[model samples]
Target: MLSDISGGLELRQADAVARALMTDDLLRAGRMIGQFCQGCGGAIGAVRLAMFPSTTRCSICAGSKLLAKGH
Candidate 1:
């Protein structure tokens, strides 16, 4: 859809933009919710939460999880 609208954009760029827009919508909808990190027991900041609204895990925990997934 975004690629169709953004005719000049590369597929990767369009995908990124589409993802960002969708994520922004998700964050706006979930802004009031205080997402907690299960691993560190830390509160995820608004900026981080806005960037990643679908997950309860904070960036630090998410990064470690990703690292572990590679193993």
Candidate 2:
């Protein structure tokens, strides 16, 4: 399947990519209905949403979340 098409990619990498794609699709669908930040329940701006359709959080919350995770 995806691993074969990806030239024998590791199973874990393939799984991660598949999950990310699914999550991205779900987030995009949510935006189509009505956009909101999944992190802080804030309104997501149109420019930001357009820039990152799969984003689930506003910039402030996203930055904080990343910092919390030490990333």
Candidate 3:
């Protein structure tokens, strides 16, 4: 679907940003409550939103956070 493509783009962009500006404490994503993505400041995908019910950042961002945490 068209929506799926757009969602992938958003996640890609978020991943790039997270990689560029990542620190230590800001892990596990931002947890924005709307259709927006707190990681890259983009829109959240419907599927991603459904999967990450409590997450603010996309899957990539969440993974990066977990990596930082060593888990």
Point to the candidate with the largest lDDT. Answer: 2
Clashes of 2: 0
**Residue pairs in clash, model 1:** none
Q: List the candidate 1 regions with Cα displacement exceeding 4 Å.
A: 1-33, 65-71
By summed lDDT, which 10 consecutive residues of candidate 1 come out lowest?
A: 1-10
> Which of candidates 1 and 3 is the stronger one according to TM-score?
1
Quote the positional error of residue 51 for candidate 2 in Å.
0.6
The candidate with the higher TM-score, 1 or 2, is: 2
Each model's lDDT comes to 0.73, 0.76, 0.59
Give the true-structure RMSD of model 1. Answer: 10.5
Q: List CA RMSD, all candidates.
A: 10.5, 10.1, 15.1
Candidate 3 lDDT trough over 10 residues, lowest sum = 24-33
Q: Candidate 2: misplaced stretches above 4 Å? A: 1-33, 65-71
- Candidate 1 matches the true fold with a TM-score of 0.42
Which candidate order results from sorting by TM-score in descending order? 2, 1, 3
Tell me the lDDT of model 2 at 12.
Answer: 70
